[model samples]
Target: MATYVNPGSAQAGAHGTIYREVSPEQLAVEQQLVDNVVASFDACQDPRLQELMTSLVKHLHAFIREVRLTEEEWGTAIDFLTRAGHITDEVRQEFILLSDTLGASMQTINVNNQAYQGATEATVFGPFFVEDSPAIELGDDLAFGAPGEPCWVEGTVTDTDGTPLAGALIEVWEADEDGLYDVQYEAGKRAGRAHLFSAPDGGYRFWGLTPTPYPIPDDGPVGKMLDAVGR
Candidate 1:
């Protein structure tokens, strides 16, 4: 194992770990490597692809250099990604969990969707959001008999101009008080989730489980990462 130490620091013995300060020559070499990698994509035909690849490589290299990343740590990251892939399935997406836990998902959303005056901000598109969710009429109970305290959620959909937007699609889903989503149970089980359209007055309301806090799936690699980082 290798570790980075500040300049002028001294260590006793190397017990399966080597600590050292970065040399100026080594720093130049690292920059050269990054430059060469970035230049290799110069011939890419698509400007957007080339730009994305170059930025990704530059940032990744910068991160590695900033942390003085060790070979062991790199191997651990590879293993973590492998485990994430293994745990992903029809209903489970470890990669999304990884992104969500890292705040990357929310950051991406924020970057793409600019904030307006007092409007709702976009949130993470979690893996549990099912397509074609059960459709319900306004004022109907979206819980569908799911066990939880009855709570009414109502709002008016409007545009930035303060005009009501009729027929706007409204989708809502959340875990029950037990901190379990419908997808966590056996297949074909749907609860605490529904989609409805706003009425002519741009008003919609439905009965759903009261909002509750729930933990992300922590039995997988992403969970291990959070635990490892003391998050």
Candidate 2:
């Protein structure tokens, strides 16, 4: 029979040897790693770190005990995370989508947009939005070079009470008839998109083909996880 002792632990009959149980200081450092993430939950200036960190520490410690996770399990998790990062690119953002699918994005949106009760409910902004899209005039077609069914999208930005928010900016972007964003197609050319500003009455109209829902990029670790989960 063999006895195993964690490093820094004292063995029996080790004369004058002192063994210090894991101190609060060491625990605090380990706890801080998780705390840092929770503390960032609130928009700066609200500082919910104390509450978040406390809960995180409690659950994280509990999880460690619950599974009795070994270092190998932790290492595999790290590798999975690394692969997830490696598969990300400009057109594909596995990490952001992972967060959204996991409900973290919705949670963050709900927490940060507490003031948006009257506004249109915000959803997770997918990763395909392109800045400086070719600005087009109202009623201009966004699917100029694409081949999807032409659908007209008309909406009015209004306050919660139904008062129109005149001159509000409503930017629109979506995939073309081929179910691909401009970024997904050409390397540099901006295609299959258009941007239009709202009218004075908070109304905006755009002509674009309705986009068909497609499976997110399935070539990454996130995709593999989804497959494993039977999603």
Candidate 3:
């Protein structure tokens, strides 16, 4: 038999107080959070945010129902999320990587930035982009002080009419020769890095050490989840 206690009562013993099971009111609070999110969207002026938040709530509620999740599983999930927050920092985004591996990032980008039919297809902007990188002149090498196989990356930004879009912003970032981005290195060096601007004719070029594929970071709950999934 289960015993009920006041909302704020404390339980004693090794097993601790089991507290009252989730009440109807408690479940209503959870559902209300989802409802509020949807209702708030109507007040949102930004179309993008409205669309995003609306979809987010819909899928989130769907997931909860699909799993028929238990209280223990929910508590474990909260713990995992807390740990993920603790592990995040200026150079690391464990949550973003989790989204990437789950295809959420790709889905968001694809949904928001539909292709223009003939334009280069956009892809996921992985968690390695660094803002305000030291700008370099045309044809300058971005490898900086790191060592790796030399490779040239050249492209042109152009308008739909096949004419180059000169002076377009062309920011480039990639992994080092060892398949690691500068943020991944603790030595405080910017290797296999670069920033270049498009020319008057939309042509842009820069040199950097060739990048190699590397495994994603595997030191958090997301990593554990991936391992469990045999990814």
- Best candidate according to TM-score: 1
Report model 2's TM-score to 2 decimal places. Answer: 0.70
lDDT of 3 by residue, 1-231 (tens): 223334566354234644444455765676688788788789889999899889888777745643446889999989988998998887788889888998999999899888895888788877777666778999998888776788988888898779988788777777766767788887355666667779998999888777787778787889999999899
State the weakest 10-residue window (summed lDDT) of model 1.
10-19
Clashes of 2: 1
TM-score of each: 0.87, 0.70, 0.74
For model 1 the TM-score comes to 0.87
> Global CA lDDT of candidate 2, please?
0.69
Could you tell me the lDDT of residue 186 within candidate 2?
57
Q: How well does candidate 3 score on lDDT at residue 84?
A: 89
Put down candidate 2 lDDT per residue, 1-231, tens digits, no spaces. Answer: 112234577354244333334455655675576557665655645447556665766687645533446899889878988998887776667788788778898899888877565566777787666667788777888777776788988888777888877766566777765567777665565666667777878788888888787566667787788898998
Off by over 4 Å in 3: 1-58
lDDT of 1 at 97: 86
Residue 201 lDDT in candidate 1: 88
Clashing pairs in 1: none
Judging by lDDT, tell me the better candidate of 2 and 3: 3
Instruction: Candidate 3: give the clashing pairs.
Output: none
